[model samples]
Target: MNWLRRMMYGRYGSDQLNVAMLVLSIALLLVSRLLRIRIFYWLSFILLVLCYLRMFSRNITRRHEENQKFLRYWFPMRERWYRMTDNLRDCRTHRHFKCRNCGQKLRVPRGRGKVSITCPRCGNQFLGKT
Candidate 1:
């Protein structure tokens, strides 16, 4: 499939790290079969999914040339960074904290606060001491 190679080879740009990561993941998957490590195999499969997710996720989203250098130069690896933009946006909106017992995400007010919080999910009681 020359079209497939041409399509993959020249879009935005290319990445050695992603290619290396993909290759490493495939190798790990193969090795896990020999080593009988189920976790390694599952993790290798997950990494492969992440590699593909990194590759084609941009087709569904918008891209900017100025703000994202990699998105301009090599778009395939931009998904993780693109996903982080939501977290960065949330970080701009309010304060984020973790629960002590269950590590739940708690978003409090953006400013200094003397507030008591109970995590609804974990029922952990803690003060918002930020």
Candidate 2:
């Protein structure tokens, strides 16, 4: 453990991008094995190698920039995923709706019969039953 810690010192180490790469590589490898695809195997191997390269990189600034770049594109999708999961979890307690004009998502408490929903985005009013 001492040796490992010493080796990791001054390295870029792991971040969300590294973990995503690792997971994607493993998934690709599994799919390749199941489907017997040579291309997927090669792609996964390259991805795994990139993950390790990033993990052991001495260029901390470069690695951090790369991670930030990845996050720029990933954060929005991640937020949507969290929102979807939360909505699913709270399905019994709340009713979710979409605005007709702006397509904005709105949530209301369940069991509110014949309620008027005014979209905050476009100020469009619609009637919904909870």
Best by lDDT: 2
On TM-score, the leading prediction is 2
Ten-residue region with minimum lDDT total, candidate 2: 86-95
**TM-scores for every predicted model:** 0.37, 0.68
For 76-97, candidate 1 gives per-residue lDDT tens digits of 5566778789889878768877
lDDT by candidate, in order shown: 0.70, 0.95
Model 1 is weakest, by summed lDDT over 10 consecutive residues, at: 58-67
- Candidate 2 on 24-94: residue-level lDDT in tens? 99999999999999999999999999999999999999999999999999999999999999878899898
